[model samples]
Target: MHIPDGLLSMPMIIITYAITIMGIVYSLRKLKNFPEDKIPLLGLFAAGVFAAQMVNFPIIGGVSGHLLGATLVAILLGPYAAILVMTAVLIIQTLLFGDGGITAMGANILNMGIVGASLGYATYSKLKDMNEVIAIGFASWLSVVVGATLTAIEIGLSKSLPFMKVLTLMIGYHVIIGIGEAILTLFIIKAVKTKLPEIGGVPA
Candidate 1:
């Protein structure tokens, strides 16, 4: 969920910026030598993430919510790249779309980019010994739900917006919507690994 400007306090905003900076630095280091062949794929994935996020699925009675697609990016490009892509999405939303506030950009990045990427990738790696596909699926699903849940908590904890309802709403919708994330991530990972043969050595 995008926390519009003036919703978060100063301290929270500052902390989020700090986290965003760390994430960006980490991503740049990891992507220092990104392969040229993946350029188109990267663009496609970014565009797909943007488009997918635009389509809100019905969550509550009359309310709907959108996805961050963080797990999808992590599954495809690894966690670091996923963070960078998510940051790009947040920037776009802030500058052009006005969907999220500029002050809360850092918070959004930390929520959707860092937390989502780190959780999804770390979970996948931890579960890798069992089954890659299942690991990815589970990790992707949990990452989105967890990411959104944490973000909602962050908002609720804020002095400016200490509303528990946000936590309930965000976590509620994201839990089910996360299934879509998990499935899509698994399917794409399987498809790419089967056809590409070199990406992450995933077996068809």
Candidate 2:
């Protein structure tokens, strides 16, 4: 979900911005020696996520659902590179298309890019050896839920709605939306495995 300006309290905005900036910086440092061969794949996934997120489905209280694609990117490229790819997509969406707010950009990136990629990667890495498809699907679903939960928390902290009410609604709606995410993630990962067998990180 892409949060708009004026939804979050100023302090929340400031704190999220600080944390997001630090995350971006740290992610950048981690990828300073990133391989050249993977650059095209990075750009490709960023474009895909940017396009997918453009079609937003309204949920409630200014939140929306769309394919995040962060889990797919993380599983393919690794989390640090996935962060940069997602950061690029969110920045372009916020700045060029106004898909998200300038003021709320940090929180948007934090929710979808950082949290989604990091957690999705962790889950997939832990379980892929057991069952690749299940790991991919579960991690993809969990990423969406986690991102929505974090957004709900931010909105609740801003006093935009009752915490429990919004939390329940956000989670409830996103749980279904996350199914779409899981399906798409599994499809893309499998496609990559079939077409680009030389690529690293993907389950064999």
Candidate 3:
């Protein structure tokens, strides 16, 4: 769920803005150049990601689910590019799709792109040191949970919802939704991992 402006207090926005700026700068600095031909692929992938977010799957009645694809992107592209792609997706969602608001851009970026892509990527790397498949699933699931849980917390803190009730709902739904996310991420990574060495730092 993308949050619009006027939904959060000013202090919350300021904190998110600071965190988002740091993430953007870090991602940019860490960017590794790929082949010239590969540049277009990343842009195209970002567009696809933006579109994917539009189609939300209904979980129960009101709650919806969708692909973060953060783990998938991090697996194939690496954290730098994946974070860039994800951040771009959220930006476009705010400007073009109006899924989020311009004022709330920083918050969305922090929760969705930075947490989902960069943090998930780092977590994946740590666990992947043990098992590839397990790492893949865990990373994917956590990314979704982190974003959803944080969103709920933010909204609850805004007093739009009671904190405990909202927290329970967000986590409860994401637990089931994350299973699908984990399965989907694992399947995709497994299918292409052999062909793409960069998927998990394996040399091509």
Q: Highest TM-score: which candidate?
A: 2
1-204: candidate 1 lDDT, tens digit per residue? 788887677888898899889879978787877776775766777787788788887754786666677766776777777887888888898899997899999988888778878888888888889998788888888887887886786677676454677888787878887877777677766776798675663111
Can you write out model 2's per-residue Cα lDDT over 109-137, one digit (the tens) per residue?
99999887899999998998999999999
What are the candidates' C-alpha RMSDs? Answer: 2.9, 2.9, 2.7
Each prediction's whole-model lDDT (CA): 0.77, 0.87, 0.77
- Candidate that beats the other on lDDT, 1 or 3, i.e. the better one: 1
Error of 1 at 161 (Å): 6.0
Best by lDDT: 2
Relative to the unseen true structure, what is the C-alpha lDDT of residue 163 in candidate 1, on a scale of 0 to 100? 69
Q: After TM-score superposition, what is the CA distance of residue 151 in candidate 1 from its true location, in Å?
A: 1.4
TM-score head-to-head 2 vs 3, winner: 2
What C-alpha lDDT does candidate 2 achieve relative to the native structure?
0.87
Instruction: State the weakest 10-residue window (summed lDDT) of model 3.
Output: 195-204
The best-first sequence of candidates by TM-score reads: 2, 3, 1
Worst 10 residues of 2 by lDDT: 195-204
Cα shift from native, residue 9, model 3 (Å) = 0.5
Candidate rank order under lDDT:
2, 1, 3
